[model samples]
Structure formats: C-alpha cells, structure tokens
Target: MNAPRTVVTDLPTRIRRAEPSDVGALALTGAATFLESFAGILDGRDIVEHCRLQHAPSVYADWLADDAVAAWLAETVSPPAPVGYAVIAPPKLPLDDLSETDLELKRIYLLSRFHGGGVGRELMNHAIAESRARGARRLLLGVYSGNARALAFYARNGFVKVGERRFQVGGNIYDDDVLALDLRA
Candidate 1:
C-alpha cells in the first residue's frame, strides 16, 4: 500500500529544515538576497560589509548548531538551487520585556527573481508552523522602515506594528519597524 500524505501545501519551491550541511548554501542565499533587497536603499559599502560579516557560513553554522533555532531553506527542485530561507528562534526584538512564549522570525529572504511567486509565503508559513510547534504564543519580526514590499507581505499575513528599532547594518544605523503576530489567535 502507498503511504498517504498528511499535508496539501503546494509550495512553488521545495523547502526543508536547513541542516549543518546547508551552511554554504544558506550563507550565499542570505548574502545575495540581502544585497539585492538593499542595493539602492542602503549605502553600497555598508551593504557589502554587512553581507560579508552577517551572512558568513560560520554564522549560519552557529545557528544550525543551536538547539533552539530553526531554519528552513527553499530551493528549486530541478536545479536544486537555494532561492530563499527563513529562521525562527527565541525573541530578540526591541520589546523591553518579551515573554518566554515569544519567538522571532529572525530572517526571511528570497532572490529578487523569486518575488511574487508565492515562495515567500511558503517560507513564512513554514516559520509560522515551526513557531506554533515550538509552543510560541506570538511571532515577531523586524523589517526596514522603507521596505514597502516586506511590510505589505507581513501585513497581509496579519502582522501588526508593535515597536521600533534602530538596527545596525555594518557601520550604519537604520530604522526598523517591529511587527508581531498573535499565534494564539
């Protein structure tokens, strides 16, 4: 007898929990997406340094080694190329006193070519499911204040503005809007 599928999600890209072995792919995609998403919106030198330091494979490896962190890597099935990813872990948002039940969607990005293809939603859904599975009562995220596309995406998914943060990218400081989703609802 054939095994029955328990889920019916039709994702545009294949996504799975990122393993230690996927550190390189994750690093590359993170850097590429970060650069593509901020090219004109941020200083060129700042973006370069930020990508070099923040998106290093060692950074991803550390995340993968952590017991509390969960990362999902999205890829093209035929070419097997990493196109996007999402990471969720214990809250580290601008909130002064976050509850233990709060989790943050630390990162979610995709190559510019993959935008509007439903892959971002799939990655987000994966993060939401993982947060719920881990007993998170709320999911939080931070997006650059000028990133209208990202803000729209988060809003469409029911995230609401809750706070603000001054985030550092390389040597520059930028404004970020913190958004939260009530998972219990």
Candidate 2:
C-alpha cells in the first residue's frame, strides 16, 4: 500500500501572552499602530509625544511586572511580526454602579494592514477571557467619540455607551465615549 500523503496549510495568526522580554517589541508595535490609526486626525507632534510617553518600552516593562495588568500580542507564524496587542488592567476610572468587578481594556490596537483580518477580534476575545479569568465581571474602555469604526466594532461586540469623558493626548483634548460590556451577562 502506498503511504498516505500529508497535506499542510499555512499557519494562521495567533495570540499569545506577552512577557517582560517582549516589552520592546510591544512598545514599538503599540506606537506604530497608534500612529497608523490616528495620525490623520490628530496633530503629528501630539501623536509622537503621546506614543513616546504612553507606549515607551519602560512603560511596557512596568506593566509586564504588575500583577494587575495583563497583555497579549498577535503575530503571524509564517513570517513572524508583531501585528497587534491588547492590554487590560485594573480600572482607572469608576463605572458608577459597576465599580466592584470592573476591569479596563486599556488598549486594543492592530496594524492597519491587519485591521479587518480577524486579528483584532482574536485580541479582543483573548483580552475578554483574560479579564474574566482575573475575576472581572465587566470590561470598560474609552474611545474617541468621533471614531465611528471603533464605536461600531465595540457595539457589535456587545459594548454599550454608558458615559462620556475628556481624553487628553498632549495639549489636545478629545471627547470620548465610555463603553462597557457586561461579561457577567
């Protein structure tokens, strides 16, 4: 009898827990993705400064060592590259009646090239699961009010707008909608 032939397909992108060693890569990906997502609408200097301060390697290193924070990265297996990432941490702001079990989805950013390719969804799902595993009953995030694409994506994923806040990036202040997802339900 002839040996059976084996067929192999290209490995799909995957999501993995980010470690302290990944701080540099995460920082770079975070900053690049942020710029790709918002540069057209925001001032270049503000974006540059914000990315430097918020997505610096030192900041990621600190987060990696914090027990309250969880992070994940998405990468393609064929030709490895950090395409996206998500970060979840203890809530920085109160969510009215839902304060006790609330966790914040601090960030969920993907390279523009991977935007509609399911990477964002995978990252989001992983973040949600991680939050739940950490005892979070609700997940909250603040997104720019004018970002219709993000608003629609969050809506599709069961998040509902609960409030509004002002978000500052350098000297600019943007109106943001605070959205919440009931993980317990």
Candidate 3:
C-alpha cells in the first residue's frame, strides 16, 4: 500500500501511488502548479513565498513521514513525466471537532500546460476512488474563491460548496470556499 502502484498504464500519463521517494517531486509539482495557477488570483510576492515554503525539500519529506496521509502522482515518462499529483487525508482535523466521515483532498494539481487535457480530472478520479476504497463517506477540499477555473472544475466533478474559510498565505488573507462530494450518494 505504501509503494507506487499503477492504475492506468495504457495512457501515456500513468497514475500511481506516491511513495517516500517521490515526496520531493510531488511537493515541487504541487507548489509549481499552485504558483502558476494562482498567479493572477494571488499577490505575486505571496505566491512566490508560498511556493518556496511549501515546496521545500524538508517540508515534503516531513509530509511523507506523516502516517495519516497518502498521495498519488501522475507521470508520463515516455512523453515527459511530472504531469500531476493528489494528496489525501482522513479528516485531518481532530476527530472531536466534527462527526462526519470525511477524507480531505489536501491537494490535487496539474501543471498549467496540462490543464484541459484530462490530467486534472484523472488526478481527481484517483483521489476519489482511493477515498471511497478507504471507506470515506465524503470528500472535502478548499479552493481559493478567486480561482474560478478550479472552482468550476470541482463543480463539474460533483462537488458542491459546503463551507468557507480564510486562508493566510505569506502576509495576505484569501477567502477559500470549502467543497464536498458525498461518495455514498
């Protein structure tokens, strides 16, 4: 369960579980995608700092070390690898805080260049299937309110607004809308 396992080997961009060894690559890709996609939605300085802090090798290594999380990485080695990635956690907030059986979509991002080629959807499918397989009743995630493209993608994938919160990145605060998908429904 800890090692990378291919889910779609036929497609040039294959999907697989992320392992400890792929931590750095996963973090780098995640940060790069965030930085590129949120460029106009976020302050340039904040985006730069967020990317730098979140993609640090140590940060990725630490996340990989956590026992509560799992990630999947998509790569197209034959056609140039590093396509996208998805991270998930089982109700990361303390259990006492909420009664819902949920899986947090910590992150699901694809390189900007691969935005409309089904890569993002593929990554989302991987996360959703994995969450369902793990007995998750629902899946939750937060997306910056200003990121219209991401919001639209999630809505198209069956997610609906469930809540909202302010996320602080660098020195700026951004409103983020929480979305959820009921797996059992």
Return the TM-score for each candidate structure: 0.92, 0.90, 0.85
lDDT, candidates in the order shown: 0.89, 0.84, 0.78
Pitting candidate 1 against candidate 3, the one with the higher TM-score is: 1
Assess candidate 3 and give its lDDT: 0.78
The digit string of per-residue lDDT tens for model 2 on 1-185 reads: 11222322243688899999899889999999778767778888889989989999999999999999999988878788788899998887645665767899999988766666677888999989988887888899999898877898899899999888888887798889999998888
Candidate 1 ranges beyond 4 A from true positions: 1-12
Name model 3 segments beyond 4 Å from true.
Answer: 1-11, 92-97
TM-score of 1: 0.92
In candidate 2, list every pair of residues with a backbone clash. none
Q: Write the per-residue lDDT of candidate 1 for residues 92-136, one digit (tens) a residue.
A: 886986899999999999876777777889999999998999989
Instruction: For model 1, state the Cα shift of residue 167 in Å.
Output: 0.5
92 Cα displacement, candidate 2 (Å):
0.9
RMSD (Cα, Å) of candidate 3? 6.9
Better of 1 and 3 by lDDT: 1
